[model samples]
Target: MRFSISSDRLKEALSKVSAVVPSKTTLPILQDILFELKGNALYLTATDLEISVRMTIEPVDGEEDGAGAIPEDKLTSVVKALPEGLLLKFESLDSNRVLITTNKGGEYKMSIEPADSFPAIPESIGETAGFGVVISGGVLKEIIENTVFATSKEELRPATMGVLFQFKGDEFIAVATDGYRLVKIARRGVVNLKGGADFSGVIVPAKTLQIIAKSIEDEETCEIMINEKHIQFSTERITIISRLIDEKYPNYESVIPYENNKELVVERDLFLSTVKRVSIFANSTTNQIKFKLDPSGFVEVSAEDVDFGGSAKERLDCAYNSEPMEIAFNAKFITDILGHIDSEKVLFKFGSPTRAAIVQPYEDSEDREMLMLVMPMRLNA
Candidate 1:
């Protein structure tokens, strides 16, 4: 089978689809992008069994239609290297090989797998009043950006490795925690069904959702459909389907305490900078930095590693009440969550020395989003 396609257009489309290819896979086909030509479009697809991406490119030039799978990265590189703005056409030499040529000059003959050898890709999702949510691209992107860092890299608790969505009537809540800290964000207009209300216990891997977040264009909103095992995201031209992490999310509810007494408020930028500076000298193993609150409303960020002749300390104006307190935390965790919070000042609360102090924007919280929680560190005993 043969097809003539525009060089620039083909490169742009193939580049998007090939990003899903696994760098190494036991099945060679999993390392390649499948190209299927039908009617007036070029269908480029790549998958790693668990995650799959299929992108379609509208056709061009004299073309005969066919399907084939070629080395994902190699094919992408060849198309990218073709002299800019040239037209590309490809034809299958046999069931297992293809020849690529361009109008302005450049050619490639590559071996590939039969289209039939490709693994099963997700099909168009069936409608069943499926669990759905819609939010602006900007909102979704920012929400994940702010919370994904809180997800666990350790897969011991698979649920902690993904973001959880809890639908509560007219609103929805998103929570993420890595056993170190937790972040909760809320969005409005979550449809809650009646009669025990349909709920989706879907946890999306932070990394996969990130890719889908990036693919969303400048559109106002996108639709999300959740099945028991898979979730589908659709934009105007782009569609992303991912297998949901099927694990029980921890009772995040239990981890969040109902009462905490001590509180400290500091300018967000000032606190972020001071923490960043003090972190430079933290222990390599723990990356622990200490915070000292004074009765006079001052917070000092400090860290020291005697082995490396490293130490740093900075102070910032803040709000403090009750007994003065000192706490330590993983510097990286502090900086990561701080970077996502968008407020002028942040509130830090402490229940006691052993508990993590909750960090949150100290502004007029017009809505009810939960506070970001961080577990305290153990200082020298």
Candidate 2:
């Protein structure tokens, strides 16, 4: 392929698709990115079999319409090392090689493989009869950020290793759990379904959601297409296709308790800081921290490491009127659930020391509702 593109533009395009390029793969072709120059646009694609990313850069000076595959690391390294505003020219050379020359007379040559050797890109599902929606990129990013962290990393239970997405009417819900903690975000009127189609539940791998969150601008619009086996997220210039987790998600609703009436409201930042500090003295194996709540408007956070004889405690003012109770939890889990809360004050509802505690923002928006559940640990006598 022969084309001239600005170094910055080329670098941006390569960076977007490089995430999918496998670092270690048995198939050598998966290490390279396919570059196709046609008309005035250049297409860059990379895939690791499970997930694929394709990006398009337009208005490049196309000298000849051609395609080739080049090592992603080599091309990205060369472009990133060059000056910012220099225009780079790419040309196919003899003997299965590609030559890159900068406007300032810098030149680099790298081996290239025939484009046909690369794996076939997945076909777009936009036009097919499937569930499709147009969603704001900001909303999508928020949903992914709030829940992706809670996804399980265990390979045994593949269903819990990804976020669950459900669509009904105009409401969209995303849920993720790792057995110890779960986060569920529900939003209404945020996504516009094409043809008013709805899908029940689809587990999306956490890695895919993370890539989509970083690939698109917050203010842009994202087009999502979903079928039985795959899901696609597309922006104006970038497209990502990922295989859906085929396993059925567990019955999540049955675990969420609705009778958690004992409420304790505390400043989110203050409570989070206390938990982090107290966690330093928690047992290495358990990482357990205790919450001593009193009806007198205060909660004491404490942790102890009996093996090493380390202990710490702190008292924080809160709004609690229920009977006095002591609950314990994994300090790490509490910190993670607290980090995602966006409100000044956080509300915690407890049914008992053994029941799962519910955490949420003190005030929820009319269009968005977020609820996080963390299973408590048994307090030591």
Candidate 3:
């Protein structure tokens, strides 16, 4: 079997799916990319059992139709090493190896595995059990970017390690939390549910969304098909399929405090920079930063490290309408929340020094609403 494809095109398709390839796994075949020629297109697939990505590349020329599994790293390295736009000829040396020769006389051989040995990607959610929605690539990108960082890294609570996608009526909500902090973004009229149906919140692993964020471009809309067990996202050239987390996500609404009466409006950049600087003096273990709001329209941010005898404090101008209050929070958590805000000013609503606070973008978008929560730490008495 033989075919010809451009070096650049091959590299691009390979790079997109390369993230799914396991660097070291007991399953050696999972390290290879299944390459198959169907008509004028070459199909490439890579997976690590839980998530799989398959991409199609249109070839420049072909002599025969065949399929084989090429070691991803070897194939990617060789193609990338060649000059871009160079046409490369591929010929099967048998079922176990492939010979790759560049049009300019460069050559390399890679060991191949029978394509059949690659594990089968899960079939799309069955029509009877699954439903589908269409959302823009840009919206999906923003949703993942805003929420992924808040997912829990510890495996003890598997549900919090993924982002929750809740679809109901004409609204879609994406949420992620690590117990200490939570980020939630909701969009209206973004989801077109199949058969006018609704889905309870579904937990999708953060790793899967990370791959989608990289693979999906600025296409107008991507179709998302989901069911109780599996979910798939598809565009023109790429499709991603992964198993949904089976555990139930926590009822996040119940924990969101309803009595946040104190509101503080401050410049986002100024507050972020102050937190960044004061955090340097915070205890490395606690990363605690204190917020002191006074009736004089002044807010003080401070941190102290008793172990190293280091401390820092700074006061900034703000619009404080609520009563005087002081609160303690993890500096890193506050900084991260502020980083995701796109507005010039941020509104922080606090219930008390001991209750969780809500942060919102002061200037709003017409279509989307974002809310963030950070738990307060105990103040040093």
RMSD in Å for all candidates: 2.7, 1.2, 1.5
How many backbone overlaps does candidate 1 show? Answer: 1
- The residue pairs found clashing in candidate 3 are none
Q: List ranges where model 1 is wrong by over 4 Å.
A: 4-8, 59-62, 82-84, 190-200, 364-370
On TM-score, the stronger of 2 and 3 is 2
> How close to the true structure is residue 207 of candidate 1, measured as C-alpha lDDT?
69
Native RMSD of candidate 3 (Å)? 1.5
How does model 1 score by TM-score? 0.90
Tell me how far the alpha carbon of residue 50 in candidate 3 is from the true structure, in angstroms, after superposition: 0.8
Model 3: CA > 4 A from native: 126-129
Question: Which of the two, 1 or 3, has more lDDT?
Answer: 3
Query: Over the stretch 1-381, how does candidate 3's per-residue lDDT look in tens digits?
Result: 689988888888888989899999999999999988877788889999999998878744767889998998888877777887898898999889899999888889889998789898854554744678888999899899999999999999999999999887777899999999999899877667676677777899999999999999976578888877888998888889998999989999998886788889999999999999999999999999999998689999999999999999999999998788989999999999999999999999999898999999998888899999999999987
Scored against the true structure, residue 130 in model 1 reaches a CA lDDT of 61
Candidate 2 deviant stretches above 4 angstroms: none
Writing each residue's lDDT as its tens digit, candidate 2 over 1-381 gives 799999999888887799889899999999999999998999999999999999989989999999989999888888888888998999999638999999899999999999899999875866653787788999999999999999999999999999999987788999999999999999888565665566787999999998888888899999888877889999889999999999989899999987999999999999999999999999999999999999999999999999999999999999997999999999999999999999999999999999999999999899999999999998976
Position 1, candidate 2: lDDT: 78
Task: Say which candidate scores most in TM-score.
Answer: 2
lDDT of 3: 0.89
For all candidates in order, the CA lDDT equals 0.77, 0.91, 0.89
Q: Considering every candidate listed, which one attains the maximal lDDT?
A: 2
